[model samples]
Target chain A: MNEAAASLVADDGVPLKLKLRRAERAHKLKSVAMIAPLFLFLLLSFVLPIGTLMYRSVDNPELHRALPQTVAALAGWDTQALPDEPVFAALVRDLRKAQEESTLGLASRRLNYEISGFSSLLTKLVRKLPPEGAGVRDAVIAVDERWGQLTYWRAIARAGTPLTSFYLLKAVDHRVNEAGDIESVPANEAAYVTVFGRTFWIALIVTLWALALGFPVAYLLATLPSGPSNLLMILVLLPFWTSLLVRTAAWIVLLQSGGILNGAMIGLGLIAEPLQLVFNRFGVYVAMVHILLPFMILPLYSVMKGISPAYVRAAVSLGAHPFLAFWRVYVPQTIAGVAAGCLLVFILAIGYYITPALVGGPDDQMVSYFVAFFTNRTINWGMASALGTLLLIATLVLYAVYGKLASSDANKARR
Target chain B: MQPYATPIERVWFYAFRVICGLVLLYLVLPILVIVPLSFNSSSFLTYPLSGFSMRWYEEFFGSHEWMMALKNSLIVAPSATVLATCFGTLAAVGLTRGEFPGKALVMAILISPMVVPIVIVAVGLYFFFADIGLLNTYAGLILAHAALGVPFVIITVTATLQGYNTNLSRAAASLGAPPLTVFFKVVLPLILPGVVSGALFAFATSFDEVVVTLFLASPTQRTLPQQMFGGIRENISPTIACVATIMIVLSVLMLLTMEWLRRRNEKLRGAG
Candidate 1:
């Protein structure tokens, strides 16, 4: 062969390097072409909407949308005292325009979230305003003395912006005070911080319970002969494939006060009366653990199935205790599965809404319950989205961890 | 467990089996308890049936509301599954074949809907759909459900493509078959099981979806889960149990079908 031969060339006029580059470019283009329809569909349907949802947590557009001049009037004023007469004039003029547009409740209801009284205050002003716009500030003040107070104006000024952290702050049990410093709401008003804690608490309990129950079952499936193992595997997968609503409904029927569990317990004289099982935190734990146990078991079983039993046997043959050999040799190999399963079960558990709502009492509600409450019961989009954003953060962070573990586990397997 | 283990070790083995048996019982009990309750003659959801009867089953089949929900579910799940399979199969092939920057990022975006809480996705879609006047429309529900189903298709098809032999398609192309023809003729037959299972998964996703429907659907567009949700919220009825029993049977059938397909797929690959 020629030691320093000229670079190879394609049959085409182009050099080989450029030809390879063109081929690579074509490959990328083909893939992108295939992915385009789905990518665009998801972009419009899933990605964009969630982006808008995250934006909605800090969004307070109703006041700004309906009362633009009033917001502009308060642009220069700090959160100190009331603004000058011009700002009041701007408020009254904006109020009439909002009324004429039939959007008074839009501005007033948003302002009411910031401070509790402005809904009625502004709602009263639209009807009491003069036939004309002149002396409108006095006419508005005559309608409600509280509107004349700086507290009311501060509420307006704080919420008047197109973007505010009122909802996000409120989600964490903190709010922007009249002084405009971020402060915790009075203890009595604090609710969401507890709800967030309760969500995490419930998810953790479910994960632990699932782990305890699933480990032995997974071990049984992994170690047993094919005959018994297949039956056990079906037991796991059957519940897994069942409808989530059906399983939850089953729990409701079984755990209700006069339901089967109670009926059996009383028949056996296990307790004096039927216990409060469903519609409480106990039922939440029971149902969630039952639902998530398969997720826990499947991963652990897969990892355990790959591990050879010879290592444990080797330790036992070397005069080590059987329990010691099994624990030291076998358990370490399954940590990846354990972590994967626990995180997965935890992630799914935290976002549970239908099961908890169907079985849980008021006090047993998780953050998702409150998210639905704000969306459905109160029509408070800000509060709903803020809590949702928080839950999304929790899930995404855990998923990232899971992805890391999973990829590393796969890399190890490949090696 | 070793044959030469001490007495305690033998006891531990037996004890472990019992514990595992109890856990298996726990897993199946909730599912089984609903069956007899669905057939109870009385109106009460509690135990102690007055008599064995088919009244709840009759009510479930006879009700207009339940029939409408079942029809809506049927309409939505199949349409979404079709769209999801087409998009997902194409994307999976594209992803496996091409080298591109930010491929991981694209995959992450495609799968994000699966991780995000249903409540978040529901409200987000609600407000966004309202902007384009899609709320309460069947089209809106179907499109949203289809988006949710696509990731499953992508995942299953991509997994299937991983074990694929590329030389067959290359041979087809070399014989002057068009790329589309090679895909349809050479590759499609081999990967059909993956496509079918992915479609089944997508269908299941769309069928079981309720929270999104809660925000998007009106009374007219209510799905089966939403109907059950309303029933559970308002009152405990044996009819709900009857519906639950039917769904459980459906899942059992689906599981058996999946198991059969998996074995058949394995056998075909083994022969090849």
Candidate 2:
């Protein structure tokens, strides 16, 4: 080793490269320590819990432990036939085992939460079964009169697996039949499918309404002097900074029958009586659009501010009408901003819970309302987690599609 | 300030300007109305007040629950701001200066909090926090708020770092200063605008966040927004209007301070 390297090195005569390697190792250790806190925070707070919540979607403990014999016996039974005497006896055996194990109560509560009255059905049937005997079928049939029916057998067959597809199917308005194939629920019973549709419809309407209100203001912000523009922007952002609950509450007072809007209308002699505004879809839309309008304007204003004034001037000088020039030249450039703002607003509107729940009629409630219903009111985490997963997947897919469209447009712009 | 314009064009501009000014007034009317109504002697939250008084504000300030929520918020907001600023600055620095692989993925993950719907995030956090016994604790609430606040900090800091010059740090390093010392003495002072802006954004975001707080906080740890939420649900108090007025004033003051800081930073950057 050279003199300088030797001076830096240990008395063991380690090579210069080895010493450098050791120093690198020490540096990496220090870097890892620097990043450890953030990584640990994410793991403990975000990653682990999401992992567990997602897992609960398929966690079917009751089905696994309670009906083992019936599940095993059903493997041999003909799909077309009602379960025979042996299969019925096998079910009785399973119910007795489940009762003796004392774990079926939790399962019944969970199932009952999903489709009300399942707990009583399962409990009565389980209680009627003898400790061990041939008369078990007669006893269970006495408890649930529908026990011998094919529909009851089908429901049992549906719940046979520990790894359940139940929650996922319910999320999409389908479930397993007796033959173990997916089928839609009765048209009248289907709720979530319509709720998802309503979510998108409300989102689309809210996006359009916000755009209509925000576009003119954004134009002003772009055209005005810096002082006026900044002042106007603060007004726009003031509502955004305030608590959403406070703002929505204010809307309630403003929109209620005897509230400010009606009081003003009455005083001005515009209407004969107080109008029903709160607790309706109209109120929900008005409040949501008011709250979300800033999201649309901010991006649009920023984009408009960046466009050179000369381009519009250039169009005017070239025999193009002002409106035509504005639409053809100015609007196209702001497409990126419009797209971003629409996507942002639409995604937010779909997941709206507080505003809709507070102001809207029962029919105006969206998929997220049901997600919360399962989460809090019913305490059905499985269904809630499944619904959440469906929404997440839908959001991811929408983003992917948006990313594709954005890149394709960018490519065209380059060309 | 006068640029050449045709009479028709000038007319069009003024028409649009008046329409926009009206819209801005409409937007601010509710808040402006509430401030006066908060001082109304009458219990109702309506205009044409029954003489000026601050009884509602007095009532809000007197309540132990409201004061406790304000106290909790005072503790949580700054803690969240500090945590978010630190992690956000680290992530922003790592993304901007380091040529590591998967940089784009990491950056996307950092910014995803901004795009994701607060409802979904809150639901996810609710279940997640419950499992670890963090559902009601101040530490849990602060961490959740910090996580939510990080995106704003990242966006502001990244923008600031983009304007920063790396050559100053390189020069300091070449002059026998350690990398850490070079970062502190040279780089940080230069990008202090970004850091300050990021910290301000973090604080504002925490102060405003409600959905996650609704889900994650316990009765004892209830925030101001949560308290307002309960008031909206259970009572018809003009006190909520007072609370709203106070929050608006606080936010405006904070924003003005930040704007001042931003202007000073811009002037300093130009001079440097």
Candidate 3:
């Protein structure tokens, strides 16, 4: 014991624990060194950009920059009434400078998001600003009556700050009322909530469909002999390997009103008339289910493969009916796989854009379609970022659930 | 196979198999239908045997727009694949070898590109690239694509690394080999199959990606999938079928190579 104690001390009189900790620190440093390059790259390329986009969701800097003097003059004015003449003078100054620089278009567009007619109002006023010495307030009001309204001035003042929740509120079909309370927009104007609901509803139905179709196939693949099962596995893997656009295109060829499926049905005399299949909800569901089936089957198959046949055989021999035996003994064992597959399909379906955009009718489009519309067509980055943020949150929540389920399953395995 | 089964059990078993058969057909039929339709002589996309021809394939190869898109795809996919493979393999190695705080957070950040919707990524990247003057540039597209492809590489390579024996590297280190030397000589060869598979995945991802390209690519930088999207939206031509068929063939080849590599990896590990 005394010799062991002596060995615990290093030759230079340092303790062994300290020496070991130093070595451990060096190892950790080396690992950090190895990871640093990719870490920095992802930070620059992925994380930073997404962060910047999220910032854009609430970023309202254009009006602040373009109408700086007007923003300052409106700082302490009561929002219940129209601003005084100083605010109007500030507006004239900002507008004259903006017109000189030909930058009135940008500020006007930013203000247009707050009120409908502000864009035309600002553009026209900039074109017909009266002489510099006149009373700028009445002159501005004369150029456009919108300038005399409290709501328009309120919008300008609200937008003058560096950040605002206008876009984010608009994303969920809510708005800040003139009383500064959050309330829903008119029912006809509420688009995003319905789109989000449709996205989830379709994703849920697709997940259920995939589960229904995948379970039987996974069972067969798990139970069948190696040679045949492997062959069948390739059939599942082939579609999984194909290009997504190609697969979606194939669906178009098959499901079009004059396409092969209708042709075959007519030829077989099953129906006298062709059916409307493509460019609708039916087509969207069919295409999504076909595309996501492999995701479901693969997970279930892996889990089923690990389950021994002895459990079901024992259940059968114990006087249970065959169906009951299979369900009671076999199905419960594959819950982990079921959860994994369903979560994957559901998450993927909710974010799906291409299939729905191509195959579905106008009303059937998902939230992502609108996100893209705002981005590509309207160039409304704020609205697009807000919608994207909501989608991101939904995805992260589902992923967290999956992570929890997976960890619990692992814990169960350990037990 | 169980002798204990009742008479009804056999019926249930056959019924299950039939259902499975139909599911398999559902999965494979769409992909196979595109192949013969591509060769159909009729300009229409439907069946009824309008004879056979190679006109669509000829047109695909001859059209300047299609050819240019193809050339861009070829260039962009390979470049993105190389970049993703290098960074991903390095990250995978570090993650598997290291014991560090906040590892899970790092991993989540790295894989976030995969979890986030492509529309979001495309929009985010569009705004970012526009701000930095990378809009419509090859460098911008490649960087965005590589970011998208990195998660696949990380997943595949990390999976491969899980089966690797770290003792081999330690033994090399014990034999006076430097860390880099040990990595190159002992570690890389064993993981080459995984890295190659990851590269293939990265390539396929970049090749298939259209949303980001739609947002970022100018007219001159259009890709094949971008062109296909436009065609599908505006016109239903047989030429798209030809393109889809070619893509399927390429995917099949890639799948075969991946299967072979997987078997080879298993064999190598077993031999070791």
Candidate 4:
């Protein structure tokens, strides 16, 4: 057959293949056109902001923006010793600009991250700076003697880099020592590692507890007849549907020192006095588990519901023990649900800010608390972004695992 | 019924039911506990019912702060819900209908708001909104909330669209109706329940969102949850319980509405 004649033609004698390609392109364009509005809206309102956050973690703009001339001038200076006249002159010029621009505190605030008292040192240096003069270095040193130290100049140099790992390093409880190698801070200052540890630890405990409590309830819902199961399902769903603030508020009311639960216990003479329930680890666990149990149960119930009872019945009829048969034949079918539910609960638990803030004690605060602390109280954007990036990493990694399990489960169902 | 033959089996059966019952009790009890506490007449939130009164509810409704919060919630939740429903439904339809490159990545990004730590979002938006002068404005809060609400609408609407048959629309189109008419007449009627459900979800999301409001809202724009957060944090009062009860009732009503829609959807599918 002739190649030209082999292809079919449309009614207008155009090649059908080209026509089909044109039609497909039009369809895609239509779809994209429809999606563009929402996509752009999200990009501007949500995704861009998140991107800004991730960037802020390592952005290092404060030092770079405040002292552009000093940062540029220090690029050629070796870390071994003090700088020469031009570098001091650039510092003077940068400080004058910062003073006039009202950004003197920024460079100093950044240096303070490296050394404790550097903030006030830089502030005083700026405040007491006489008019631009020949001996700017000596004048600055006279204002604050610490400014003459090489260590402080090294901090300025380290922060003056366009992108600094200072915040990220600090987040893991490590610091760049005077020798320029990463090392753990002294034991007393090493707080973030413990905080991260506690975050994951709390999340794990809550996930396991939720699974322990939710599995049986999910099993009952799966095994019961439709009439009873539907009624029982409301108990799970009503709480799930309720506002989180309301649920957390209710827990506060129930567990406060003079609250109903403690009062009830006292009235019944269950204990000599009211328990220290709220604002502690015990309260955190109870509220978190209560908040997250539905996530675990709903997934587990969906998975258990699909499993046929016949498998277990047949195993028992064939002389296998009922419990063993249930475990062997039935339990395996629900792993997908268990994995999804546990991971979901763990993920949510780690990101928890509101519930823990309300119910947990000072020691019970997690990484999210520090993130908010840095953002709100301290105005430490770098620190906030660094901790947030870690959480974003954990969430994405776990979400990837969950995505795998869910898709594989779908595949199993397809078969 | 004959499944249990051994004595251990019978014993395990009762024990399992009792355990499940307790779990259910644990799930539902906290929500119910506040209902009575809200009605308690005592100034201090104690037990044994100091006697029922509507004083707390009266205070909640009568306070200017609570009333303003309620007004703000009404304004924000509805506007955000409308925006989320329109955009999310359109996007979900497009996502389901058309083939696209990087569809999965796009989807993941769209829903990432629900996954990312809200604190990070708050910080990022805090700076961003400040830059654009959206900080402390009702528009800023509403826009942020709408973004948060979009994922729910997309998830639900995409689900409904997946279960849809394209043949009905094809028939409508072949009968000489325009594209918009086919959509409004054939496609929308089938998906209206889903849209409504998604709207309810989006509404609830906006209504409940506090972290974003904490960063974004000025005192003039304080929301119900923000006000409650302050109340719970600064001072413990039954008025907070009263607010919680109202929120609980609202959510229960939403849940019932969702259930009704689910049944109706099933009936529609069955009839079809």
For candidate 1, lDDT tens digit of each residue in B29-116? 9888788888889998877778999988888889999999999999888998898899989988999996789887898888777778
User: Against the true two-chain complex, what DockQ does each candidate achieve?
Assistant: 0.76, 0.44, 0.76, 0.80
Worst 10 residues of 4 chain A by lDDT: A1-10
- Winning model by DockQ: 4
Q: List the residue pairs that clash in candidate 1.
A: none
Q: Can you give the lDDT of residue B190 in candidate 1?
A: 87
Kindly list the per-residue Cα lDDT of model 1 for residues A1-415, writing each as its tens digit: 3332337677876667778788889888999999999999898889888888899999888988898888898989976666777777877778778777888776778878877777887777776765434565666677787867888887787888878889889999999886779999999999999999999999999999999999989988999997889777989998988888888888988988888899899999999898999898899889889989999999999999999999988998898887898789889988998999899899998998988888888888999888888989989999999999988999999988888888888999899
Worst 10 residues of 3 chain B by lDDT: B1-10
Taking the true A–B contacts (Cα pairs closer than 8 Å), what share appears in each candidate?
0.78, 0.35, 0.68, 0.78
Complex DockQ, candidate 3: 0.76
True contacts reproduced, candidate 2:
0.35
Worst 10 residues of 4 chain B by lDDT: B1-10
User: How well does candidate 1 match the true structure in TM-score terms?
Assistant: 0.96
lDDT (CA) per prediction: 0.87, 0.78, 0.89, 0.89
* Docking quality category of candidate 4 according to DockQ thresholds: medium
Q: On residues A230-333, what C-alpha lDDT tens digit does candidate 2 reach at each position?
A: 88888998877766776788788888887889999999999999999988999999889988989989888887888888887799799898888999988888
The list of candidate 4 runs beyond 4 A from truth reads A1-6, A130-133, A142-144
TM-score of 4: 0.97
Task: Please state every model's RMSD to the true fold in angstroms.
Answer: 2.0, 4.5, 1.9, 1.8
Q: What tens-digit string does per-residue lDDT give for candidate 3 at A324-363?
A: 9888999999999999999988988888998898888998
